[model samples]
Target chain A: MQDLVKKMATELDLKGEVCPYTFVKTKLKLEELESGEELVVTFDHAPAVENVPRSLKNEGHKIMGIEQKGDHLWKVRIRKA
Target chain B: MKLGILLTTSPENENTNTVIAISTAARKAGHEVSIFLMYDGVYNVNKKDFAELVDKGVNIAVCALNVEQRKVGRVEGILFGSQYDHACIAADVDRFISFG
Candidate 1:
């Protein structure tokens, strides 16, 4: 069952950020991870939830899940593909 | 990755210069670039730098209504689109920037 539990290799908190920069900073962090590693990013900006996931998926990353952490705050888990 | 830039300021504004610089860098890196011009930014459609950028294969679209409203006098060479195209560009691009 240990392999069933996915572990996160990196975490990014992008609060109070806007488009392009949010995606830019997230992409940069993802670049530093090894293949098959997972990154969880926290975003306060509403649009980033849609934009970042779409952008990351376009770059061949897999979106594991998206969950709301608090009011207007969301977390996205991505796996390098 | 596709990068979309919304330019809504006039040619003399510093935003136009930033758009040119960012688009040039993105293009050189073999990345797709799209720029949507509206409001006063439609004035750049007639400028040399923006025209040269269009020649370099950068997708540049100008708002038709703004051009007519401002009497910028646009020719048929470039894409004369509307704000709908701007929204489409923003939705389609991987990253978006607004220079107003």
Candidate 2:
């Protein structure tokens, strides 16, 4: 079971950031990772939950999962593609 | 992807925000991004956010004629070019986005 746990290459906490900046920072962080590496991004802005994933998908990245951590807070796991 | 952004509007317009957002995103994606500031867009040379864009590796050029007309003098770290430079940037990039 331990071996099955996927390791995250990096984490980006964009709690106070807004739309385009959130996505922009995420993309920049992703660029620093190797292919197949995973990035964990946390968002406090509601729109980023939808916008970030969509924008990443458009760029051909793979979204592993998205989970709500608290009220109006979400985390998205993405695999570089 | 190599992207060319042709900006003809000034910071007074919301289009300037769009340009910054798009250019930032493109640069973050490791894409080559170039911005040609023409007409009123040359006025954005002094904007604080414009400096951030330059720091992020977005190549920015201002039109010589427009800069002189506006008396913007010399802004550090920004290239001053002519229409020919804009044409060359358009020809060199894979796609050109115009914001007027």
Candidate 3:
């Protein structure tokens, strides 16, 4: 059950990416997933964590949460709506 | 629908305030707003309203070359971009209004 739940998400490493593009790429990636699929995105650019999630949410997607990976790194989990 | 607002005038004029007002309203109405500041409009980046718009999830982009030429301080949250950014904003938006 744990393995199955973990496998539900597809990870995208957008480390070092910045805003607009970060939101853009995330939008594109979300389009590739089926409805209700999860995308775990890693981001180094701080604003993308805030910007991307809001942008996605505005586009009708669900933002799961944001977790700090390092001093400045962040991971955003999103579910397609 | 997404709205693209182009502001080419300086902050000393009415364009800055107008852009802020329109962008705020559009964002509040659940529309995506992208502001591309060019020419003398680079100074708008220093405006407090721009920060407020960014906080409201608005996309504000300033012209990099204009900022460099005019010696404007870069605002952290806003996108520092070029004509390409303007083109992208113009293309992606459903409706575009200019304050030029």
Candidate 1 per-residue lDDT, tens place, B21-56, comes to 999999999999999988899999888887789777
lDDT tens string, model 2, A1-31? 4234355347889998764577778989999
Model 2 C-alpha lDDT per residue in residues B6-82, reported as the tens digit of each score: 99988999988999999998888999999999889999988899756888999888776577678886577777755
Query: What TM-score would every model get versus the actual structure?
Result: 0.54, 0.54, 0.57
lDDT at position B96, candidate 1: 95
Candidate 1: misplaced stretches above 4 Å? A1-81
Alpha-carbon runs more than 4 Å astray in model 3: A1-3, B1-4, B8-42, B45-95
RMSD of each: 11.2, 14.4, 7.2
True contacts kept of each: 0.00, 0.00, 0.00
Put down candidate 3 lDDT per residue, B4-94, tens digits, no spaces.
9999999889888888888888888999999999889988888787667899989988866677678888788888775557877888999
Candidate number of the best TM-score: 3
Q: Score the docking of each candidate (DockQ).
A: 0.02, 0.01, 0.04
What C-alpha lDDT does candidate 2 achieve relative to the native structure?
Answer: 0.82
lDDT of 3 by residue, A1-81 (tens): 746755889999998666556777887898899998899999987656755776677678998889998998998989899
Clashes of each: 0, 0, 0
